[model samples]
Target: MSNVYIDQFPAEAKVIRAAFYSSFLALALGGVFGIIQTLHRTDFLRFMDSVDYYTVLTAHGVFLVISFTIFFLVGIFTWAVTTSLDRGLEDIRFTWGWYSLMAIGITMTGVAILAGFTDAIDMSASVLFTFYAPLQAHPLFYLGLVLFVVGTWVAGVDWFRSWWAWKAENPDERIPLPTFMVLTTMLMWYIATLGVAAAILLFLLPWSLGLIETVNPLLTRTLFWFFGHPVVYFWLMPAYMMWYVMLPKFSGGKLFSDPLARVVFVLFLILSVPTGIHHQYLDPGIAEGFKFIAMTNTMFLLLPSLLTAFTVVASMEHGARQRGGEGYFGWLKALPWRDPVFTGMALAGLMFAAAGFSGMINAGMNINYLVHNTFWVVGHFHLTVGTAVALTFMAVTYWFLPQVTGKALWSRSVALGQVVVWFVGMTFMSNAMHRAGLLGVPRRTAEPQYEGFEFQAAVGSIGELDAQIALGGVLLTISLGMFFANVVGTALNGRSDDLPANEYAGALSGPDDAPLVLDNLKLWTAIAVVLVIFAYTFPLLSIIDRGGLFGPEVIPFPLTVESATTLGFALETAASTSFESAGEIATSALTAVMR
Candidate 1:
């Protein structure tokens, strides 16, 4: 048996594997919670109770959204950055320390949720995972949040340290394309999270502990969204990197433009950070002008997303066309549909980006009125984050499973079937959710009721979608279980082998055909930052009204502004429908907060 030690490939790969397992295991747990929670709420199952539902919700949010996505991204970035640098991981101790801290943090948070202490601090905020103001959970939740963030930060530092040391050892060098992209992302993450982290640790934590008289809820919300929005990209960047750098090779072609990928990363880093105020479109405390600016800026972040979409598609198309595929759709047919890495990334990317197109509406000042906090938001994110982002993780896992454990997957067909079912189920389910939102079905409520027949009909239709989604979820969950079993079994029982050499490798710099503009991130990053500054400046400044951050008793801002004043503003707050009684859509906002 070939002995592929932990450091055989870069320690980064091991870290990536560790991260993958961590996220995957956590996600499996989250999925179990989600399935149970969804079923209990819908009456699809009668076994669970309110306490179980809430606990599952807490676990799902904390683990799936908070833990899985971030941890997976960290590991992938580590692999990409170190591999690009052609070096082993720079600091083994730091890597292990970061991993251990994250594991401890996640475990602590999970245990805390199970112990029923979440509502101790502020019972009202226990309003399902988003933890919006007026409702409060125990201080343990906030502490858990802090610990998770710290764990992530430690990992982020390790990433930076490795890349920096590599650069220092080779002074006169341009950063490798993949490593450069990751570094810029982490830099943006550091800058972006600072506000929310401060708001949480200094304000929310203390307030929850009864250590402070009150926290500025409005300010906290604003800061939270600011970090919240860009965090999606933080989860997504490695997937993008893998798509640009590795997918093409797996499909038998070179990356079309190394530098263009760099530009996209840098652009996302800067523009994605400050445009979070778009989430506050429905809130009153923020000024109209500030909201307008943030809305405008949100549109700008789409450019980089579009650019990446185009670049990755082009690369994939080129690979397809090269493989004896001819005309338009022919290239699609020629794609390596059987290869886990290539097909999985391509399908996931397309669907996620397609779903993300709705972001334009969500970001728009007028359109958001139609569907904010409704199933539309739910549908959009499931496609983008749930489908697209999660699929990437799956693809990477499948691609590298053998290398990490030195065994073939238990069943390739099972893996492929899982991907297909997920795509199909997500499409139908999200579409129904969007339709339900049009029917004014609010999110976060256990059930929805309406007076009109049309509304009832819509609700009836939603049942079908929900059923389909439940089925899809079941299939996906089963697939995940099989995957975990395969990996574990392989690790334990499979013969050992040397980890494969880096297969889809790219050079630090592109060939002579590379465009000059693609090589530099500074310009794109600057443009993105400027765009964000323009977006968030006014909104943030608007928070300091005289009375305090809340409203009326605190400030001169009108409690009721004319709809005309809202001009491009989307949703009408005055006529907002509430679910005071059971069986109607819940009014609380679900934080699309997780990246």
Candidate 2:
């Protein structure tokens, strides 16, 4: 009855495998640096200074955040889109071009960072990824970034081209759910990357090269955030896609509202990209009114995110009920616990969405001041991005690996242990970070030093948190080691040619249902473009009167503690110049200019 063969596994699977290999390599590199940074933060490792810290940070950011996530998404997007259309990878000519460019760009950027070439752009201590203006990286770093982004863009085009050709071939059919979501996310990433691309190519690169003594750091930061904020959504989109499209089916239920999931994707295209200005709330260059609008829009974004949470929960509930789960809490146990795929996704979704709830607070205007640039912010992101998103990726890999390689998992027990370790470790790590921030511990440093007041009390608490993180990491590392072994082992030893073709689990109707049309993201893309333009207009316009908007550019570069406070008032000078006559105006202006 079935004719598909192991050796005849879909070509898309091969491409995905290659992509996973690349992404896993990057993750490994980044994770190593992440561990080093964590150790350095807790004073477990003190030999690394600022330069070393930044180098590790940059590598982690570029490789892990940029290269690994984007590349993995590209492969997954392509696979989902092609499979849904009942086709293999199309636009084959450009696929290699895209991969080559991305591979080269990632390697070059990593080399530049490790070579200390990033020092060219006032690397002093700026470890911010997306390197918002007011901080800079070398022109090579920016170019590398541009090249990498272009590579991803090329991948997007390939996806659309293939999907479009598929539609033309079969004009009457609807696209598959998984593929539709992939296109939606691709459209979002394409629109979002433009802002950062512009900032890097138009501003940061030139400024780093001395093309302009002052390139208006405010404008640069504004543009970078325009890209930066949405990119987070981009990383999460695939995870979200899997959560909505696959998780329910894995739990053994119909997707409650398939159409609603699409609508939520559409909403993200409208809302997420335009709210970047909220990140600039504390900065003076952006107006309070503009920031307020951004903040309000950010609040609106919670609607779609919450909608997603509800959808996932309801779907899981259906699965639980299907399995004879009755009570509210009983469904939790009724879930397919031994099925690593279902359980992993459900738990990861619940945990990450919990983290996302906290993110709403971080995105708010006034509340941001309480955690701005602090470990609380750090903790919040790790919960969402690191814990939530990363776990989903892991879930996917585990779910699909056997299918891809025609092998059974080498050690299910070990894989389960790994997920538990990662989750427990992250909770401890993030909670400690939140408490540390409340105790006034700053983030993005090699060492956080403190003076007399309750510092010892604070330090004592951190030791327990740090120990938890270390133990968790050890467990996670063991799990990860098992995963690598399982995958490689299955690939080589368990190519069971007689095994059944593993059907991709998802929220599809029964054999009688019509397939979905691969909808064009053109409207969504256009709406996103318009929203981004509107969002950035006021922020960018402020740069027109550079001196007036951001205050006169004064810099020997970094600011002192006293100047930092003065600069705060100076940024508000445009609305009220009373601070200019405070006799402390120069110091304030200097801080404002330097920051």
Candidate 3:
């Protein structure tokens, strides 16, 4: 009798399966766009006009990061909450509702972005992922984002509701580790998203609809970063959850310490939102003092990451040792390297360590100025969200698919090769991106090469860098193909009665060993809120004070002929009115002199 998740909670499994498929669809679209942009930027191939690059870039980012990552994590969180609580959701209908909302919302947003490629739609949102002001998108874009965020908010509420019901049933028990992670992450996300929500709902949406004439660019940017930086953790925490809970089991051991994992998540909740300004060190409107404070907070964030590394590595080592492996380093060989689930996550973690070192350079205000908007920043995130979050998700899918479908994985060999191929491809691509950035290569452009000015590389020529990027992009595309093949092949396979029971790693040092204070959700949520207030209140006030709620005369970019003509007429009218007022003042002065 296999006690798998689908057997225990058949209703919930259906929703999770739906979420996973939705995410896979987005991944397919995003991956296609990713290759398109990569090949185009490298000048290896150019199917579309250079002007349409931003549209492709926008689609790639929003689909993968927003739709793909978030949809998948929400599913994982659902599984985690239900599995760890040992109970089903309060209502399956509610679960389906949030998923549907997310699907519809992302579809609308995706349509708005893709419409940019066609002249027939009369609508476009080529504003890129940041959707930064001055580069305004169509109103549907902002509206869709609103719906998407609201769906996530509802999803968080559903998780809380489950926890609340479970707490009522078991009054004296501490929160489960997976549930703790989910709650803390949701709390951080709730806080972090407020910035973007405010930006879109209050300002960007109104402006896009022509209800507001202008918006403070600095203010919108400040608001975006507030959400932007913390959103990194929002993506990462799930991957971290998988590492802490699943990795050790796959490694053939129990978790090292339950308390340590709880503390790391708590720290992430409290510190993540306040550190977003580290991204804005080069922006002018923000004072040096505030940027410095953000930099300080960002540095503090490293502590949690370091703790995670220590605890996870320790857990893996313990697992390796328990498998009858003797010696210090030799035990590493005892790990299940043949398992795609294990190797993919292991490689993802190794790449994330490298990301952390590069991230340090990005977090430091002084050093960040050198690569603020350069290709280096791109490479840094490609490692974090791109590999760390993405690779972990793909790797885990090999394990997760079978559990949900009641079927054996179609091909472990292909799964193994897929993960390795992704790792190698990213290495080549991200390495070249970092090197090129150091040589003053700009990012987010159709063409990197200028007519008169050539970027002089310190080591390799620019052509070689381009070649590496193109080769890497090709390899990554191939990896995506293999991944999809496995997914499709698995879905086609017949159900198997023989499957491993669904379970996370047990902890050697259980929750009983940890202090009760670690599970105080209210206390931590309060502290996280307070930290955000302290970090943002003054800087936000200063920005609004300097640049009015709506900024001084600024025009939107990628303007249509109609909008351009209107802007020209408005400018001419203003100039004429000013000149007439000046003449009247001069005439009054002359009359006074004659008298």
Whole-model lDDT values for every prediction: 0.69, 0.71, 0.93
Q: How accurate is candidate 1 locally (lDDT)?
A: 0.69
Question: Model 1, range 1-595, lDDT digits (tens) per residue?
Answer: 3433234564555677788788888888887877776666555775854534555666777678778888888777776766677677767878888887787777766666666534343232233555554344566667767777787788778877877788789875667777777878877787677766877787667766777666566777787888888877777777788888888877666777776776777677777787787888898878777878777667877888888888778777777877888887777888888876666677788787767667787888888998898878877887777878887778767767666655556666666766676677677667777777777777765555445643554246667756765675666666567667656665665644435445564533373445556435556557656765776666656675532543222211111124225622433443343323322433233223331
Which portions of model 3 show Cα errors greater than 4 Å?
Answer: 559-595
TM-score, one value per model: 0.85, 0.87, 0.94
Off by over 4 Å in 1: 1-7, 10-13, 50-54, 117-127, 450-460, 496-500, 505-534, 546-595
* Clash number for each model: 14, 5, 0
lDDT: worst 10-residue window of model 2: 509-518
Residue 223 accuracy (lDDT) in model 2: 77
User: Which residue runs does candidate 2 get wrong by more than 4 Å?
Assistant: 1-9, 117-127, 453-460, 469-479, 498-502, 505-520, 547-595
Q: In terms of TM-score, how similar is model 2 to the real structure?
A: 0.87
Candidate 1 steric clashes:
14
Scanning candidate 3 in windows of ten residues, the lowest lDDT window is 556-565
Q: Give the better candidate number (2 or 3) by lDDT.
A: 3
Task: Summarize candidate 3's per-residue lDDT along 1-595 as a digit string, tens digits.
Answer: 5688888888988888999999999999999999999999999899898878989999999999999999999989999999999999999899899988888899899999999999998899988889988888999999898899899999999999999999999999989999999999999999999999999988999999999999999999999999999999999999999999999999999899999999999999999999988988888989999999999999999999999999998999988998877787898898889999999999999999999999999988888978888999999999999999999999999988888888889999999999999999999999999988889898998898899898987798999999999988899999999999999999999998888899999999999988999899889989999999999999999999999988877787653556657778988999999999999999999999999
